[model samples]
Target: METPTRTPTAPPAFADVLVVGAGPAGSACAQLLARQGLRTVLVDQHDFPREKVCGDGLIPDSHAAFRRLGVYDEVAASAQPVQHVRCVGARGGHVDVPGTMSVLPRRQLDHILVRAAQQAGAELHTPLRFEAPLVEGERVVGARLQGPEGQPPVEVRASWVVLATGAVPQALTAAGLCDRRTPTGTAVRAYVRHAELAREITQLQVIWHGRLRGGYGWVFPGPDGVFNIGTGVIGSHSLEGGKGRRRGRNLREMFEDFCEVYPPAARLMREGEVLGPLKGAPLRCSLRGVSGEHWGRPGLLVAGDAAGTTYAFSGEGIGKAMESGMLAAEALLHARTQTPAQADAQVLQAYAAALRQLQPQFVLYERAGIVNDWPWLADLLIWRARKSPRILRRMAGVLDETQNPARLFTLSGVTKLLFE
Candidate 1:
């Protein structure tokens, strides 16, 4: 179904920048560019307040982007505070971490970012389908969009085009930045409402149980008497089954099984009424995807999932997505200073450099995905953390990014955890 649109408006003949998606990355990029006095047009296939498949959990990483966009207070006021995180191991061993996190449904979150972009002087267009980029030789001038219904195809031009089309690989693939079939994982979430469930819980739980040895399932308490329950698994692992059978579990089957077996999850979902259908989406992570040269082509740049900035292990993309957008904006601003022939390469090089600096943790997570495949190691880590308060605190700090992940791998660090 087409997302409902706001008041109808005509497309401009030209703009300084054309953003081809109104999600966090697109909205943040548009807002930042507009604030810098660039004429920006943001378009999306779905309208505001639309449902997006996600865990709805916002960790410390999302704080900077919200504040930068001037919507931190608004989001904070409406969020359900998550004071602690609990990870349940394979053998039921566990670690509980105390920290600050919250849940704000993407409906409210995306709306906030879109409105913020509008307020920042960017023209917002929704219910518009991005068909292709408007290309002249090697430079991207703007985009070609499909108008509502049979109205007509519309061509809008801009000096630079930004693709924030999210996890759908079509746009990126069409741009030749990614292979037609990029590796992807699946995630499914459903919302449930129950007063007792909300009243008794204010924490997030990630459980590694049963068939979910490699991936995990989560239960996140949402604001206003709701819960976001879900499971995510890499595509490669999703097909594991019983005995010698080759059949695999689907996302729906995984969700049902997860809720049926996990104690805390079962308890929360017991009497709660399901508020929405189980929705699923593909996650394009940093596992094996495109790079800077692929992302930054002449007069074009990609951000968010289209650029595969999501963390490899956790699949956390909101913070990284927004960061990429802001980085793109900064690069474009710098590009304005260079000659026409040098602008594309300059922005590309600058954005690549910035991403390298910002994503060392994610790089480690990519390598750590191998360990995640080994349930015994995961169980050991959780079991050890459950026995040591100091290690638990360290893990908590690592989650908040206050402590470096590299330190956790050091000889001294492992010794302290083992003996202290």
Candidate 2:
């Protein structure tokens, strides 16, 4: 047999910053950096308008970021606006908590973000996969990238690098930035189209049941008659040092069970036409990949899902991903006014500190994940929330970020629910 051959690499290209992965995080980071006149280069393995396995739930947190990125109006134009979330418990208890929400397929959403980055003057490269990092002693000075088959690899030299690759990131491993390769959580979803079913489900539905002790299911309304339906569970990867090794005992079974148990899901399956095969994607929840100050190697910083920006309980990551990316951009902008050595030390340190500041919120969500194990609490919360407008308002607060989740997921909150 003929020996396999390695692709030859082209001459090195230089930039002020090299961003791998042009998802929301990478695109947001690149846009901010490029807007500030940093010669930013954004590369991705796939082209634009690509599908990203997601529920496409845009909450208030996401809206804030979209506004700051100057793409709020455009996103709003294409998204299906929602007014509330209907939480259904195992006992069939349901409560509709009013809040601002929207649904847009990730394929279109991510394309909008990439366009914003391009309009901001960031150079975009596609079919370009990150092969490895260029190391100089302790610092990562650049990276090795390869395009599609027959295309020569490209060497990219940059003053700094940002890793925004999503969950299941090989780039993290290549750059010596990965902590655990296993996914912290996993989800399966599909699009269903039925005129009647689509019209019936006007809001988001989050279902919890006894069989789904370690997970939850959701049905969100996308643009037109398409409805996004799915289930998710915390997977084998946990920060608990293997104590939380429940990375979905059986995801397919769980999904099938969800469809059977939840009436809405059953109706969708029976009455609606599924647009495509049920797709599954891995999730890096609870920021399991990075902790403390080890956010990145020298001269490099990690952002978005690669750095574990996805939350555990609610499974909302888009806003946090964009926030982390913007924070990385902020750190770089601030460091530009300092000495070379000081800038290097301060940039990574600053980015790490900023990420830590977000840790408390993420920690609360992680703690709240206990609801997946004890779904009775979900029943009680819905029961109480329906009767007590106070509890309902608090739920709204959680969505608006005006109130902490502790009000609903904590022991004290549970006790209050009983009394209230």
lDDT of 2 by residue, 80-162 (tens): 99999999999998999899889998988898998889889888888688899999998999999988898877899999999
TM-score (C-alpha, index-matched) for candidate 2:
0.94
Q: Could you tell me the lDDT of residue 25 within candidate 2?
A: 95
Please tell me which predicted candidate would have the highest lDDT against the true structure: 2
RMSD of each: 3.7, 4.9
Q: What is the per-residue lDDT of model 1 for residues 165-235, given as tens digits with 9 covering 90 to 100?
A: 88877777766667535345778898998888787777888777656745678988988888999988754
Tell me the spans in candidate 2 whose CA falls farther than 4 Å from its real position.
1-12, 239-247
Instruction: Return the top candidate by TM-score.
Output: 2
Model 1 regions more than 4 Å off: 1-7, 235-249, 291-294, 404-420
Q: Estimate each model's TM-score.
A: 0.91, 0.94
